[model samples]
Target: GIFGARPYKTFYVENDQVTFATLDPNFKEAVKLSADWYKKGLIDKEVFTRGWGARDAVLPTNMGGMTLDWFGSTASYNSLSTGQIPGFEFYPMEPIQIKDGVKSVTVGRNTTPEIGWGISAASKNPEQAIKFMDWWFSEEGRRTWNFGIEGKHYTMVDGKPVFTDYVLKNPDGKGPLKVLQEVGAQVSGPGVQQDAEYEFQYSNDIAKQGFEMYMKDGNTKRPLPILKYSPKDIKELDKIMALVNQTTEEYMQKWILGVSDVDADWDTYMSRIQQNGIERAKEIVQQGYNHYNSVK
Candidate 1:
């Protein structure tokens, strides 16, 4: 959720057994509140009718009050600045934790690596690619990439590396960091070890706060480890998954728009899923989960 926006939180279930999850009370409350909002016309009528239209309209402007967006740190910073919405102040709220909750937040593994330099498998000069990769990971190359030409892009301040005034001021209008990237400065990616201090220096305060929040609230669940299945299984799973997602969207929209009575309609929706082979789908998912757990 956006920093300092609604008191948003996430709950995870072992599989898709949301009904059995300890978070049902909170979820029920949230759904009721949303329904109330719809009835009160506080939320847009087309919010559920049209996919993403409400979001597209609401997210870009300072509507109702100062817009609070649930977006990536980089995107949020860029929007506030580059999008020219001034007087925008960003403050990161402490990650909310449910007291006596059944589960704490799970932090996920398999984070996307920072950009890495990879040679094209079809490259003619495979040897050169190998050499470049080797050099890029070396200490000398890292220093050159991060610090830049000694006295130009950065200088040591209190024995710590700092961006030079020239870079900070963006005298050339290209921005020092942009210029460096354009010139193929750093080798970033999954395999690369970035200097944390260097990154901290360039990152905005809000971004830093967001990062901290992520560390605090992020999930610890690694991506489900599953292998490729038979083509028939793959096709069957895809069809069933698509149907489940479609059903979810339909019911969620209906519930949010006050078009469906939650107490009654929810049960009907669940029944429909059961009739549509939800148990079989759950079995497939469980198999995949089992495969992942076994591999890990």
Candidate 2:
């Protein structure tokens, strides 16, 4: 509901075809709904004025209300507010259903993480480096990378790696993240990192509940494919979209803040967006997408 009813991106593929979704009908309806919600006081009055730190500034106070955020951080507040405010809690809600019988797709990560290890071409021992990287994905190496050494940071509990008190409940007042950094269990290196129980042990029960809810089948899915465009295509897209994105953000803010009526201003906004080269941007993205699928 922040931008629109439908998930909005510069471009997203639906039915294996690229679409300029910001100008699409579903997003138009979303703009209208945002306007309506703003008028009805469902949205924060200070939404536009507040910077990204709004979460930090607002959430600790009594005035803090609903927010759409990551499951882990969202649940952290419940623990943060524990002694300060009685009965203060935050939990994840299922994505709002805009239309009956249609499930909403929560934008999720690609299976292959964007970050990875790479050996330098000038490396003296490239073969040794390759072997070292390969070891991280192996069974024993995975356990070491994800859980640290046996009987130190973790121990076998019914053939599962369970974090010890050093990582879970630090003797000092350090949080799980800090302890994990010291213990070297949760570093972002090459590995599967399939240790679900690690997150459960670190996070509070509320966060665990939210994690379970979102991880259930059909609750989350990747929204876009990992499409790589040529440098020339990227340069062209960047030029076109810089102006187009500016226009879209301007109109979305205006509509959501009630500075202008969505019904009155939408046509002009669409014209401005098109004049800013949305069509050309779509064409470039489509070309890249088509090439991506053909190769696949």
Candidate 3:
């Protein structure tokens, strides 16, 4: 919810135009609120310096109360920190509202799959490779890919496939996720439809409950589609947005840290962003998005 106070991305398409909502009134309010929270010691002091291992550093030590992370990772902490922290429990909360009647939408998966497989042109067994790929989409193949081999990783319970003790309770002190990874189940990439049963059987009761709670009222929405840009356009965009993003992040962090007053520095920041070619960056993004939609 803290991060959701601002726009999800630096740039997003609105009404077919790439928009930089950082300058919006709501975003300004969010930045102001963050500064106020930091002053009141509400926000974490080490948030910026803690780096990626912040969760490992704070969560297990009982230093952090709550974290805004993925459902699986967050919920699993309840089990992972059982002995280290006597009563360490992480419950998934409902999406918080940014304003009185405006509920925030949790960003879900992307519009299109990110991973895919392809056959090489120089492959000797091209026909066999194609046949194997086609079989992966078949009913039995999907089941195997999602749930692993029957009687080995899972057993037929009544009519549905249930994970065996090997997956649910590994003897090597490894979690189900690790075991699943080792055995090559529940790791199917794009183009293979994952079975819901895998999730149902793998997740704990708390995780399952959280899943139902979050998906109840269209509380989630996919972000922008992965836009494909021409080679030249991509190079141009990379050059422009990289510096723009750096400036944005620098100012945002400084404001949140109360190192600089947002209101006082707002004009200077805007001038810097303008000078950084933010307008040109937005145009490139707009063109890419339009081209993507047109092709689709």
Candidate 4:
């Protein structure tokens, strides 16, 4: 369960097996904590009653500061507040452990980078397109597209690319990334071969600091090998997850707001899903996990 969070859910993954623990004592504690906050008038008065846009409007007003969003989002919030707030900062903090020497935070995966250029079979300009694609992915072309001209946005220092002082210092009042954006410097995203080094250079100092904090402990779960799922399994998962997600959010909001008592209604909640093919859905996931390990 998350720290004093509403309607917290728990699942343990060990040796590639996944299982939920709604009846766990820790889950009960989290529910009680959330309810206590509501009772004491310490929580958002309209927490469960407002729509997303209205709820989010409170964050900028300092009504709610805590968030579960990632480093990039926190960086955006802090940067966007530059002229709006006085000395606002958000430093990413590592999670605290319930027990010493035990890690509790779950690690997730970033999309794997791969060489992905392809010319359309019906293209009239296939030859020219391929030539352009080749140059784009090349080292010299990538450096220029990602960092702009050397001696301008960046320069070579001891054979490694270094951002120039003007770029790093942002002397023109534009943020480092904004300045890079003006010059058509490539920003990493889907289908682009993300140059991690360029992204670090584009980010403001606070974001770079956050990145360092993420790497400081050096203890994180390495990604599992990419596994192919059968088309049948993929379709089944999509159908199951669609219903599961909608149901979970609706039920969770009720429980968190005390409209449904978690202790009294939790078993029925689990039973309802179990009757709706949860076992079969879980079997598919486990099979995929097994295949993932077996291939390597």
Highest lDDT against the true fold, candidate: 3
Tens digits of per-residue lDDT, candidate 1, 1-296, equal: 11111222222334533121212455444566678877987666666454523433544454423223332323233434454467655554544454444233333434444245667889999998889778756876666677665677777678766877665556554434554565555533436555655556666667677567656534334333334456777688678656766675677677887778777776676676666655675566566555655676
Runs of candidate 1 with Cα error greater than 4 angstroms are: 1-29, 40-56, 64-86, 98-109, 112-203, 217-227
Q: Would you estimate the TM-scores of all the predictions? A: 0.53, 0.70, 0.70, 0.62
lDDT of 4: 0.62
Summing lDDT over every window of 10 consecutive residues in candidate 4, give the lowest-scoring window: 1-10
Evaluate model 3: give its TM-score.
Answer: 0.70
The local lDDT score (0 to 100) that residue 284 gets in candidate 4 is 74
Clash pairs for candidate 3: none
TM-score of candidate 1 on Cα atoms, chains taken together: 0.53
Clashes of each: 10, 0, 0, 0
Please give, for residues 1-296, the per-residue lDDT of candidate 3 as tens digits: 34344352456655676777675556677788889988888778998899756776777667778777655545666765656778777887777776774565565666446556799999999999989988878988888887788887888888878888887776754555556667676664656666666766767777877888877766764456677778898798888777777887898899999899989988888888788887887888788788888988
Off by over 4 Å in 2: 1-7, 101-103, 113-201
What is the lDDT of every predicted structure here? 0.54, 0.72, 0.73, 0.62
| Cand. 2 TM to true fold | 0.70
Which stretches of model 3 miss by more than 4 angstroms?
Answer: 1-9, 80-82, 111-201
